[model samples]
Target: MAENQWSTAITSVKPNEIRVRGYRLDELMGRVSFGEAVYLILRGERPGAAVGRLVEAMLVASIDHGVTPPSTLAVRNAASTGASLNACIASGALAVNRHHGGAVEDCMRLLARGAARVAAGADLAAAARALIGEEKTAGRRLPGFGHRIHTDDPRSYRLLVLAREAGTAAAHVGVAEAIVAELAAGGKALPLNVDGAIAAVLADLGFDPELANGFFILARTAGWMAQVIEERRREKPMRRIDQGAAVYDGPASRELTQG
Candidate 1:
């Protein structure tokens, strides 16, 4: 085989035929919902109707968190520089890293580990308590359990309720609930955030935890484009290149001396 040769089973295009994960594009058009299509492309199979609905809810929850997010700010700043729309959106996506939009994946890994412990014969609540204790011992802040702005994340609560109604709540949801209960027993009242709820749902849906952040990025692209267009329309070019109120917190200004 050629060293540079690459093969993929994801998609194939040849002579007016396009297939995604074994499904003909023509057949899927106007048939599968966007969320199902996303699942098909990523997971190699389309999700069931209920799972598709849950996927759509996750996308909606991640779409935007106001214009104050770093991703949105990056997009608007790039738009101010007269960059192309694609560039602006790319900038925004690039800004979503471990600190900004990474909790979904993090929480998914935690949930998976806890579920495995339960499957190995440990009591569900006991496993959850042990996990929390381990995290606390390591001085690691638990992700997806708290929010800076919301005392109780309405999105998280709604997603859980919907999951119950959809009959899709499974071991992952139970483990997540157990973790919450353990936290409350410790007198730390941290409500689950949207990322945490999405993490649990994705686990129940059998998605790879590694893809959680990517899903978030895919959903947020729509919001980034909207912000880019709005910034281009309402703001002046290069308007924020320099903020007049910036302060120098370093050493006093010094003059260069001739050698």
Candidate 2:
């Protein structure tokens, strides 16, 4: 490409503009924080205050779900197997593509669906059970309600409790809490794991259900890198073989047989 062709084409801000990318920094500065800026960059509009803050919190919270995170584990596994940098990163993405990394978003959808019923005073327990039943009928696994880790994700519960105290949309917070309590009492002790917590807090704050998971994927990518870093430090990554295709009788499975 021509030198600075794109630079000249895009200049939203000048030196005195105090801009980001092209926006005037001074004007858009307090109008939105870094979190809002993030939204603006990705979606081209500043989200509402609640949304901005909640999205930021979700982003901050999405990182490093310990080494068990498949992305992290994939990186480590790649390192152990002697994968290339690209391959290692690819592994991380592969891991996230599965449900493990995307559960928060799935949970968000469940909460929103349940939220309407809860708002109508459908009974929190009933709402949860109904939601789970609906999901089971759809042949889908329920997302954010349960956790494999904590008996009760204390962090999520604590955040929900605090969000309720924050002004505006407190009822949504209550609804989220009620759903959590109902599910916890009925199902496994899993009380609002990370996904559920993010879903509740973001939904309460007014983020779209999808944004919750996208933000999580963005943050979890870092954890993947962290694993790669650790693996690199210990020993270079090893590319993992797709065991499904490993051929044992390459010679015996002759051209005619292969064809």
Candidate 3:
């Protein structure tokens, strides 16, 4: 294949002309909110008011958790090392994976599966219960259920409320609620976290699961930039982090031995 043969339906560009999802880029600049633009670019259509709110809310929800989040730490650390803003932000984004700031994709997949099961006639409650049980039995924690800090994530609650008010709450939301109920029934009060809530809401809004993590990266980029800027302004260059606070339970330092 020739290089010019590589094509994209997302955008069309020529001299003095730019189009995205069939709209002139200049037309979209002031008329559409960033959230609406994001939806239009990714989903190929402008969102209804509710979807706009939902997308905006999703972006706002994960903007920052604090300095302790891996992404923030990465940004701060790189900034302390005198990295450029772009490099610091890139380092921050690179820290997002399954363990930190990455539950959205996993939660989206889970919610999608639950929604499908419900569409296939399984009761929401039953499906949720069974799925949660299977995950627990497999020693896997539900991606959007628990948080290390908040007992209840305020952002999750607000997003759900907005989704309901926007008339966008549907099967995936039901599945998420049912999962919460199932966890409650099992005496594990794992409330839905923001990642899970966003997954359900976005699923209801018809997003493909593959876009879930990308959405997170997009949203959190703002936070990374902010944190990087703050670190550069407030912290000394290459500040030494004390490792003494970490507990050492490993084997004692030993001399080399012949096998």
Query: CA lDDT of 177 in candidate 2?
Result: 65
**Regions of candidate 2 where Cα sits further than 4 Å from its true position:** 1-22, 25-33, 42-53, 80-87, 119-121, 136-139, 168-175, 236-259
Give the winner by TM-score: 3
Which lDDT value does model 1 have at 193?
80
Cα-lDDT of candidate 2: 0.66
lDDT (C-alpha) at residue 149 in model 3: 85
Q: Give residue 177's error in model 3 in angstroms.
A: 1.2
| Superposed model 3: Cα runs more than 4 Å off | 1-4, 240-259
Q: lDDT (CA) for every model shown?
A: 0.84, 0.66, 0.86
Q: What are the per-model numbers of colliding residue pairs?
A: 0, 12, 0
Listing every candidate in turn, what is its Cα RMSD in Å to the true structure after a full C-alpha superposition? Answer: 11.6, 13.0, 11.3
Write candidate 1's Cα lDDT for 44-147 as tens digits.
98888877787888888889876777888898899999999999988998998765777888888888888899899888798889889888999887777887
State the lDDT of candidate 3 residue by residue for 1-259, as single tens digits.
8877866899999999999988999998988888899999998989987788789888989888767777777888888999998899889889988767788888888888888899999999987987897788999889888888888889999999999998999999999999988888878898899889998998899898888888888988898887787767766899864433334444677867832
Clashing pairs in 3: none
* Cα error of candidate 1 at position 194, Å: 1.1
lDDT of 2 by residue, 166-227 (tens): 44344445555666665567664446677777767767766676566576667776777776
Tell me each candidate's TM-score.
0.85, 0.69, 0.89
